[model samples]
Target: MSIILTVRRIDIEETLNTTPSVLPQIKMTAQLNEDRIWIDGCFDFVHHGHACAMLQARRTSNNKENSMLFCGVHNDAAIEYNKGTLPVMNAPERYAHARSIRWCSAVVEDAPYVTAPEWMDRFGCQYVIHGDDVTLDANGEDCYTIMRKMNRFKMVKRTYGVSTTDIIHRILTHNTLPSTDKDYFPTLDELEFCSKGVDGFSNHCYVFQDDLNNMLVRGGYDWDSTNSVLILGDFDLFHMGHIDQLKKIRNVLEPRRQIIIGVTSNESKEIIMTIKERVLSLLSCSFVDGVIIHPSKDTIENSSHDEKSKFSKVYNIDSPELVDGTVFSGYLTSRTIIARIETQRDMYVERNKRKGMPI
Candidate 1:
């Protein structure tokens, strides 16, 4: 079966350029004819967990009618005031991340932690979706109580691994050494190992080098045999733009080809995210097959250079080389394509609804 990927685009320049204010206002769209599923939370560091929640929201729609997933992220002040700590990523950063996800159609800026009925009505929301986890306000009251009482809320099963807090803890305790057993670290905040083998790689981070090596040994993937696409970038503040680029690459390559991403750990003054954060973000995306961490700066700069290349010799061929009977080429997507993508996404959703299928 083929996977149907959803995509949404707000004004590209406006979304990128706008600075999210402390008390950002929500500008309601004039066209709210379709069924809208609303997901509200502080979507910081937009990981697999958040993506799964959006998917669940879409599934909950049941494809009976035209539906869109609108996410409402809590502003920085609300998060700090209630949770006693500020989010790792700021409001604008989080907004950009949310806007980039394919499943999310619209975002409600400066969303209140406790959503009101009027708020739901304002967005034409039939269901307000959230994870199974119960969230409490600063006053120790259930934030979603009102929605639950009104039967407008639905809870999706929370993903088992890699939370925003877990990433924060990893960053906070980045200097510690791995334990001898390597099952887990002794620190209060420890990264866990993937025990379920290669299949478990998506859910958890491999803490031990031996564990990862063991998976590689058991899986036995022939690197040179496969036609692979090598993507090299910092991938900081990973968003839909990054995913779109990867998707474009995937569309051109043969299905047998693997997509390996090289995330440079080289520090930059302008980068807001740490190297670990960047690596985890890249790993979370489904399009990526493998990630190379901390590649040498010199090697990354001269990847096309005719020298001792660590990449397989097949990819090391000179300019105008052909791999798997396909010529190596590049593309730069234009702004006009954004509108087409948005239109296509709408058509796809409508078609799925007509067929009684989930998108």
Candidate 2:
């Protein structure tokens, strides 16, 4: 597998002269003591990789619990100008998706494509965080050069094996229907790698009965008996459609009722992302309180009644309760995304090739 990594050499003198500093010295000095960090990106097709970056960014602060991560999503025009293509999702949608992540304290929409020291100061962020991969501007220069000069830039390891390009490639190559024959489950090593930044945080990922029971014994799910709204689905890609549904559910439900998601394991279904990946994606959502890894259909049908009574309302992806009445729904499912790629296979294939994916 090809790893995403980039190293850029910068001329300090040139960068300092070219990059404009808009923040007053007094304001900059005053904000230096804040625990806020800024992370900006064109978070199209937001996935686990983006979530991992947010988690790692949150860890940069001296006090993890008190740290605030201000996430910034670039607007459509900026993304198009810099990347040569409009994002899969628009600015508002991307902003909403980024805001859903558990680690994000605030979301800044219409952020500049290039990281600006003034923008960081505007948010009172002590540092700006990004993955190791180099993001270039329309001028073919490192977008973070200015921040690097200001000594306000931080780098996190890029999560290998997944990206929006790779996902689009998968959709182009694979059938939309779920396949039980294909071994798409992640390896133990990969799981361990993704679990790295989550060490000191609350344990949100869980397996079925056995694992969940162990977690409960360790005080993972303290509201097991609470009245909650239950939502179940494959949540394969876990994109904007899923986020919109969760947001709607949260709006309709009482504030005191927790929203728990039951992610169906991939043992019997065809899913693009593994169960652990799905759990991590769901846990990042602001509306999601807990995730329960449930067995396949037969097992779910046979689950004890005591387990069923814990939820006052239950909804699946197909439930009318979650759907907004419209011919053109804002929701985008994994299948819908796959169909989109399939419809434009040649274009996506070329796009992935340009991104250095082996085609």
Candidate 3:
């Protein structure tokens, strides 16, 4: 015997403008909710700038409690065709990067470079969000023109002082200034820009708190010492590799085990991002349950007993023991990212120069 299933077709128009009388049942039964917001990008380098856009979109929802921010990552072909250059990270890497963001509810892979209303409709996204900066296609037309014409577009402030271009510029120039140097560190305003919409840590605290002193930034989840796992690392640049490692830890560990991240405040000359920036980056990850900002080597060893007793299992990512074989060995590390730019130094320098960025 064979069984047949009948699926109900939902009218997109009715769902968008549903009244109490018209398709009231359909509204409640619809798989896609009205609070879904769409944001698409190449997300080549996956920096705080991309994270901020998604955060702003989630904050803009009509019902914050139930809002779902769907992130659409464009494929390599689309990026190459529209931007005249292939993305530094491939599509799978880009998708994984977007998936790790705390604000992203879902990841849509292989999205078109140009925003299509049909694609947005298919996801039942009420509005399409993007940064204020204009994105143009190959023919010099606005990428979001279709969404703008339909009045289903929303714009958030573009994060300044940081971009893939700027990162590439720094790599090409080998600008590894000390984190304490005023010129090297991001300004208070720029730091606060990325810290906004973070749940547990206040923007002021996140920006002004001295990482040299020990501090803990808790996630939105409540602490439960009985069911927690501690992982420590510098987490500089917070790329897909970090996300993959966190995912593996989650998979291997017991279900519902909270993964707390311990970020070392190492002022090493090799460190690219500051401790605060690193903390913010880790906090933005969906897998991270909390972040503990600990002082360098000896200081951590001398930490108070009360702080030390919180976790039953501790895994140092720099030298993992518990999840030895499960650790990710991907090519998405900060070193490799810098190397990618270093290998293509002239190309990146010329790209930044064309964008009017200081060489």
Candidate 4:
């Protein structure tokens, strides 16, 4: 789905009601039996590196199937106060980006600079995870010191190739950046601009397109030949039915075909697990080839097998521009389209036809 711009309403009552005292009362009641893995960072310009960290954190739990990853992206104020610079992506944008990541189960809104024990208790997180790279606060104190002393800290190896800081520097010095070093993926905004296509191009646009194509090649996605099918659903209690559906779709798979599953982040009144836990569940199912975080506009129905069975629709995207326009489109590897239909909202499954035809 294309990232549409919208004004997200904020709850004033919840905002003003979050006093320090209220923190204790806001604990995650569900997932008592499941392990919550906590990872916190600025996550300003989320990249492959951040995704790697989240993946590593999810693997730390003893029960891989029962583990949930909760990402705490520091708010804009916290970032500026601690790092002497505001994040390129504001708090909310960063939150959405983190939530959109398949590895992140849930994103904590406006996380504090310090990880309080109350936070650990509230989220039911047993361990605080971070990359091995050291990060100190403005006071020159290790940010994870408290957690480390309490024996609740574990570090994953940092991704070697790129970092957010490196991307920022590249953006600033794109004019003179070396050809061998041209490796940054375009942001959503940049991708949107590229979607305008070459017909809308000029000499300057060609230059930009060349750069984009370079990034796409480096990302190992062949934009021209890849075909993708988007499978939409909540996949909350990922079961045999879900796997069967994937198998049915794969039965009709063509060469170079990719399946993308969009899981609803829509809030549910009777939710048994956090969005993070639900994501982890779907991920464990071998049927899911890719996962997209779909923000639910309305309340989701309860987790009933009958209701889930209705999520058997397959969409044939007709527009090549929507599919191949942006590198971020389609499957994570590349080739893409913007399918706005809610993955769980409609049931347009064609029962007679087994495999999805390319539209």
* Whole-model Cα lDDT of every candidate shown, in order: 0.52, 0.65, 0.65, 0.47
Q: With candidate 4 superimposed using the best TM-score fit, by how many Å does residue 291's alpha carbon deviate from the native?
A: 12
* Whole-model lDDT, model 1: 0.52
Q: Write the per-residue lDDT of candidate 1 for residues 125-202, one digit (tens) a residue.
A: 767888898889989898999999988788888865546654433333332223233422122121121111112232
Lowest summed lDDT over 10 consecutive residues: which window, candidate 1?
188-197
Q: How close is candidate 4 to the true structure, as a TM-score?
A: 0.48
RMSD of each: 15.1, 9.3, 7.8, 20.4
> Which residue window of length 10 is worst by lDDT in model 2?
1-10
Q: Write the per-residue lDDT of candidate 2 for residues 18-131, one digit (tens) a residue.
A: 222321222223345346778999988888889889888887776745566777789999988888777776676687788767677667667889987766766567688999
Ranking by lDDT: 2, 3, 1, 4
Model 4 regions lying over 4 Å from their true place: 1-34, 175-227, 230-359
Tell me which residue pairs clash in candidate 4. Answer: 105-276, 322-337, 323-336, 323-337, 329-336, 330-336
Off by over 4 Å in 1: 1-34, 175-229, 233-359
Residue range 131-152, candidate 3, lDDT tens digits: 9899999999999988898888
Residue-by-residue lDDT tens digits, candidate 4, 258-349: 45455553343222223343343343332334444442222122222443222233443223333443322233210110121123112212
